[model samples]
Target: INSSIRSTYFVSKLRRISQIFYIELTPNKNLIMSVNGIYAEDSEGKFIPATQRPDGTWRKPRRVKDGYVPQEEVPLYESKGKQFAARKPQLPVGMSPEVALASRSKKSGPNVHCPIPGLVVLEDKTKKKKKKKDATVEKLANDLTQTKLDNTPPDPAKRLKNLKKKIREIESIEARLLSGELKCPEKDQLDKVARKIEILCEIKEIEKQIYWPIDTKYDFCRRL
Candidate 1:
């Protein structure tokens, strides 16, 4: 009686626990800004702006210096005969091909490596030669496929065919019905043997056409 009462109490506790097993958890979606601030690396330097709360999201960029105007408006602002260009002479290649009509094939930057002093040379030809050598090495690689074929045993097609043929012959022999003179035990043995042989043949045939196109299965059975 005591054991039964104890089990009942435990089961009741389990049921209560299960009732509230999954307490719905809500994610706190209201975002608070990170304390460290976001940092982005650039060519100039690592950019980390001060967390200016007063000028936060509503801030606009300060206006450019007096001479500067929008690139399109600058042309109109200048006099017709004299176009204004930056005093700074650009790198020899100038700006992009589409913008300034500079030659697209013009070299971009100087080579860093200086094997021989005083000559700022590009190791371009040496790189090409190395690539050619790599190609030639790949081409001369021995075809190791023949070695693989030699190591592997011959195909099992002939063995499989023989086994199937033997199974068919055995099935034929077992199918002969026993006379009344033969006991029930003998007749049962013959039936068992015939069934086993049939199964073997079926397995072999299935193996042969395992990759066949389709089966003539009933649509109702297939759907279920």
Candidate 2:
């Protein structure tokens, strides 16, 4: 009998606790419903109805439906053609479009002119300076050529020394070639041989000139 009474007491306590929990939760549920039904202010400062999304998040509403426009409504975007038309220059009264355009182009600048449509002709301002610079360079080049011609005949002693140095080099190269110490392509070897022959001929000419002094009066005759 005592166990049955204890069980009844526990069951009554559980019912009382459940009733208190329901009373406490009822006001919160009502508050959530009220908040969901509330209106929100959009960017335009206009109050619109707030909506609850399927994910339980609230979506702020706009006065107009999102991304929805009536077919009869004016488009929000301005086309390139309409923009070009709006930006086109207004012609003066009694003036042809071509005449007005030409007048405007003339007023723009003297340096910029167009003889043909779509082709701009620019005057080169540096042409005179470039011509002057070129003339000075040509004059300098001519002076250099004249100096080279005046110094064409080298001193005999210096010329002999140079020839002797070249002959020594050629002899060394020949020795290397014979001993197989220096390797060269067939074409290079042939060219070196030809050069050695020319140097020998030049040395002979120089020695002849040094041994026998040619009279300047007979020099012209020898040329003939």
lDDT of each: 0.46, 0.62
- Write candidate 1's Cα lDDT for 1-224 as tens digits: 99998997786666545433311121321221233333322333332322223322222223233343345444345554444445434533433434322222224643344344332345586887898899887766644566676788745565566666766655555554343443344665666565664556555555544434456332322232
TM-score of each: 0.19, 0.30
TM-score of candidate 1 relative to the true fold:
0.19
Number of backbone-clashing residue pairs for each candidate, in the order shown = 0, 0
Error of 2 at 90 (Å): 17
Q: Write one digit per residue (lDDT tens) for candidate 2, span 1-224.
A: 99998997786666557644543454322211222343333344323444445553555544645443445454578899989988875764455777656657776565555575444456676975787799999999999999999989988778887988888877887888889887763776657666876776676667667865665233322332
The alpha-carbon RMSD values of the candidates against the true structure, listed in the order shown, are 34.9, 21.5
The ten-residue window of minimal lDDT in model 2 covers 27-36
